[model samples]
Target: KDFKSEEEKREYMLYLDGSNSWILKPLNFIYNLNDKAFFLNSDHTFEDAGTTIEIIRRAFENSKNIRKSDVNSKAILIKEFVDEKNAKKIKEEKEKYLKLSAKFSCNDLHLELKNEDCQKFSKDSIMQLIMIYAQYKTYGKFNSVYEAVDMREYEFGRTECVRPLSVEAVDFVKLLDKFEDKQEIQDALEIANNEHKNRIKSAKKAQGVDRHLFGLKQMIQKADDKTKKDALEFFNSMGYEKLSQNFISTTCTGTLDFIGYLLFTPVVWEGLGVTYLKTNDEVIYLISYHEKQKENAKNFAKYLNEGVEKFKKIYS
Candidate 1:
């Protein structure tokens, strides 16, 4: 059944207040009558994307061929895996002043590139190149880049941030903008890819700079007043400001068979959030941006496609 109007759709969906207390509990199944879509909403405080995906897969397997009425009766019990005290601490640490904003719009792009074009490079490297080039073409300059790195190999771990804009990456994107020689661009790409791989390795080992600095800042809050003041001053410096902007936030979920797409709002109003899934022959991306922002998701997707085509020619 379709919703008669937007108001009816909102009335049918589960609405939460500003507190978002409902998110603290178990999973929530929200159905949108307008799009006839179902969404599983979970808090990041409890489960990360990897665990959530596994839960969804299990629920899907259990519900296969089952009656619609019986589906609700099938309970998927998750264990008490999260440490309560730690979870509470994490939740408390996240409390901040709220500034409301308008909703962001997203565009989805599914592109199929010839395997040979990307065969020489890692999927992640290629994606990173395409993203950097797209950003340059869209905004005419480089910005801080963030790629989510899963840290679940460690106990009670969630994710760490990998800043992908290395000196080599910057050089490569510059060369890309200038239409440099194919050999020069290819060499720069390899160097950038290597740097990206190193960053991923460091983040996976929980040695990334972001989390360590975050933890240090949290510790500073409990330090002596003078120490805390000094630390806060440095944290508020322009150097830190630029690092924290994260104008290009991207995450690649790899080729998850169950996931058709992923969407997330940009961390900043003027930034872009990109989530991509790469399969054997195709790469699918969901690019999100605030409507008020100068950059358009549709236009960014166009630049991304152009970058892909450029890569095809370079490799050929």
Candidate 2:
């Protein structure tokens, strides 16, 4: 309900102070009709001091909601005066509070209408100022304004921080070996073919080309020298050689890390040697960077050790 007058406002203030619903308590004491103001007028309650009958009586006269019958039940809650002018100041401050709240609301709507660009958001705008003012008003503690701003900022920060996952080095080899099993190899090949076909279809539809070779080439060009060197080293470590000419390299999308996975496929096969090579029969390792999937690497290594222990599998 709207605070219509000074007494109504005072009642609301008392209500806020006495209630524990808000994060911070607002009032410290309750006064009755007749009491000498003590300790900023908040040192004693009506129960502790019997002399508050007059003050309560005046408050009741000014308040419309204070029924003659309920006066005995609801005594006035009092708080320490930050200053004698505080009640009047708070009364006046309500005007500014309402204005700020309204402006903040408008700002929220405007920001939503505008393009979603953090850099473009006005630094001194009402929305930004409202958040800052709210923080200052609450002194870093809980308040309605502060809580609202915190939630908005938290969501924006989370969106900005989110990124796609990327594969790591150790599992690169294990994925290849996993495909060595006939059934697993067949399933992996099907998945790879599906992906390849989808990509080819997308590329052809978009650019009228069966092979998006130009796009892959652009990715190879965009790669930093360090990334290229690291990629070559990774490939060599897996017994794969760099293509004499990076033919399909010019066309690619997505992050360099994802592209690196695609690029690493040939290297894995090459590193294993010419004996494993087949014409037009490419292999794609089903690699995941999921932390949980890494347990499979340990299991695979254990299986390799067991096989060697049983058959004494010789190294080349």
Candidate 3:
């Protein structure tokens, strides 16, 4: 072994070529160390991926005292008995969410609303109103809209759910145009605030319109053929559910005060993504669509800024 010099041992290895490799065995589990990557399971439901993760975290990690036995149970929130009415509603909403799948892209917007302005107009309600306004200004109308609700306040199972708010937002936007005075603006804000609060209350108790509708869908699915057919027919007749995205989904996420650098990237390598995150001093809005829709996303950012500034001036 010592017959040749050290230089001769390396003679066959010229330039340390990385061109050759051989596999001796395979491994079962996979490990990924790349921080730049994100993922969404192909089998997941149509709910926004970011919201889904936050929901799981709240139900399991945040709430330490949740009942382990109720892990997989569904709520009988409204009309415990399954009927044609409930099935139709669920099918209609579910169909709307599924049919409106767009492309994948992303944009981050940084903005600040002072504490004083937030007192007069609720942040959630105002942000929601602004979205509707921007959509109307751009697309003229949106048949259906989505608002993700947190249902963790109730003493239920560990699995969390979101309430899909089906509202006449286009009609509401029309009403906004008729407001000529401060009284009218105040009235509008009041009504929107009330609706927002009511949605949250209903969602917490499991009586949320969407959650109940979901329960109904499950019940009707287990029923006879005639029932299922009837529900489908009724759902199809509703034009609102059929109309795809003139609008998109929205949600508000929490942030830390001390952490200077933070990343809340969720995997949406294929479709759309949107999330609202806030620290003590600022709010960051992230919206994403497919690469081809970059122009639309850019315009939306402009619309959002204009909407916010206008709202600020209206009641100022």
Candidate 4:
């Protein structure tokens, strides 16, 4: 507003200290004289020194601010400008292909459509492929978003030759069914041997186990009349007291649950000079001798029956 002469503006620009101005550099408005030469010859040349620099600086600043404001606005504008109904166009383009075997190529869609790779496909195959892609994309909500553009590639008369197998067909066979023909008995033996070894190791190392230690003595001392009466009845039923009297006390120190031991640990009898007899799928101990030693066999038979009857009463 203070500028009153043509000389004022020329000297103002020509001698302006903008070259030393830090503010002008950041705004990209710092003007060398040669670049500002055209403006020097223009009609509004009578502007003041500080005022002209401030005005030019403000113009650049306003332009930068305007651009910053327009970033989001321009993006929305471009999106709004696109045809929202381009799904139909996309579908029409894809409808030309009968097979989509490879990954989609954006570089040569036109050439791909022009090629003879596509052949006639069944409508059912196309429908199946459509469902596959729809299910893949929508994660099972194909019923709603089926008409979207992203799914248009599915309607292209294309079919995937590979179809997923059913759950029953894929998962029905048990492991035993597959492996039994090869090594069923070997696998069973392996498992049984491992269990036996673990049990033997645990029993040998069970130093402080107190659950069943002194169990018989504890029960006898704590017995009510009913328990004492039950014990007497069991002895009477088996004549167990009379039978045990015949076997020396030193040989039969441990009262064994002989039936349980026989059932679960049949291997124990193999070392005791007795052969196991299988009759009606039940195991019975037999003493077999080829030398006609009938006395030894008879003694073994009595001992076996005595042990069996004693175990039956105890376990029962």
Candidate 5:
């Protein structure tokens, strides 16, 4: 403990650096909660600062279900479902809502998968596709879906302007229940894979419609009345009822490989964040969710494993 006084740390925070809420959720914690085996221990050294920044940027950038606004400029704000939810809480109700929502946050589960079992679907496809399918089967509903994309190949003003590789992966998930024929199944997979590939391409080319609208939304929020109303109307048409549950939910941590020297268990603020990682022979599935409110992290993890197993029976 080198710090002799609390004032020293306060100086560093008050003047040296300060962050707003926009960057709060992904500030990157170096320690664990109650000595939990969640964080990537810096005890094992690395050549670059790859693990932290890349994982953080990829998750946040790629998780948007972008919708466009009426504005001509790239400054049009994209309204999300959460933005439309009429959370009209009074003073006392606000306190209660906070307490209730807090209870459902900060949770995770650890599981493993066989690489061979995931062969046909590939690691990314099988994990996302199966998870969405399970949610549909379990909830029997439609909602928005988002996934993170790595946009390192393209250039942005920043180090790497990456975003999520998002698509309506749920559409493919629905196909699983719709058809049993071999041809139908093959066709669905092709469509799903094609959607996945296209999303990556769109994001890399800076044609990410969602975030572009989100940026517009940001500007309009501070703009005059005439522009804001039209922007709000565009979002109103989309409706907010489907937001009660996110399809793919939050894109916290995607895939990580620290030369086989990293341990990752990402925490999700919405629905769930699937952290796909691996060791020598085991593929680790770390599902992070809020506390058990409705369907939780554990059941999602269970359903996903079961969903994959059923697929294996047919394909393998």
Candidate 6:
């Protein structure tokens, strides 16, 4: 991949910039010679995390097969050898435990909840705990909460938003805050779980409210002048602004064994982004946030851990 000269490299770079053929193969290979590492970068516009991970796994598998064939061949094949000494030094320099206050931090907390616990309580039960923590952090008010729902069942479909904040969720959180009655709390939790399930179902069917409103806004851009004026006025209203602010953005990235961790910045400056995976024996969360935001990712993780313990006690 090396060019003949500096001028040739410059020309090749310009050619890539001007060519549209790169869109057909949108994967980037990054290598760190000092650390002896290889990284594959996939653009989010073309692939979601799930698809990207699958692609990477297949690519690695193919490479392993090729290496196996080379082992049996008598012909010599050029290979890049790893610098073990330098790689070990680089690995040692990287911190094992990172503080959440660092810019664009990520924290992965593995909980004690098992697959049996997941079966005993719905996923909504876990989400209810998250909502309670959000309320605690926001001083007893439920902010706009979002969860991404994959809509790839339809042709050319992408994702839809599932707003998790609801009247039932608010009631459940409030009851847990004030009362300790087991039956009352269980009933409220069940109601909230049902409401959440319904919302998720609606989103999966592409009947969610957010995307519909978004589509309307897009259409308004090409509407007649009078219609565009009214649509713009409505979309620009204060109520719409409040509704659009997602204070807690969350998504469950499924239980793919190859996925070690996932992270994304908060949607809004003061918001929190949470991507989680539930394994057979534990739940892992990768919480992300801005350092200067009012909310602290570490504190939120602590609250969520406590909430998990409380949930375990309730079901125990």
Put down candidate 5 lDDT per residue, 259-294, tens digits, no spaces.
212222222354554545433344445444455523
RMSD of every prediction: 7.3, 30.5, 16.5, 44.5, 14.9, 11.1
lDDT string, candidate 4, 89-169, tens digits = 644544432122011110000001111211232222212222223222222211111100011133431111121111221
User: How many angstroms is residue 117 displaced in model 2 relative to the true structure, after the best TM-score fit?
Assistant: 53
Best by lDDT: 1
TM-score of each: 0.77, 0.15, 0.59, 0.17, 0.57, 0.72
**Residue 193 alpha-carbon offset, candidate 2, angstroms:** 1.2
Report model 2's TM-score to 2 decimal places. 0.15
Model 1 earns a TM-score of: 0.77
**Which candidate leads in TM-score?**
1
Order of the predicted models by lDDT, top scorer first: 1, 6, 3, 5, 4, 2
How does model 6 score by TM-score? 0.72
Q: What is the lDDT of residue 24 in candidate 4?
A: 24
Clashing pairs in 1: none
Order of all candidates by TM-score, from best down to worst?
Answer: 1, 6, 3, 5, 4, 2
| Shift in Å, residue 44, candidate 6 | 3.0
Alpha carbon lDDT of each predicted model: 0.73, 0.27, 0.50, 0.28, 0.48, 0.65
lDDT of 3 by residue, 1-316 (tens): 2214422222211111111211101111111233322222222233333444554456546457767685665734443454798768765754553344322334568776665665554566666776666656655555244556665445652222332223533444555655467666666666666676666666666665555555666688787999999876655565524432224656665553222222222233322345666544555667756556566667767777776666655567
Off by over 4 Å in 6: 1-40, 57-67, 70-102, 128-132
| Candidate 2 lDDT for residue 124 | 17
Residue 138 lDDT in model 4?
Answer: 25
* Model 1 weakest 10-residue run by lDDT: 9-18
Q: What is the lDDT of candidate 1?
A: 0.73
- lDDT over C-alpha atoms for residue 20 of model 1: 36
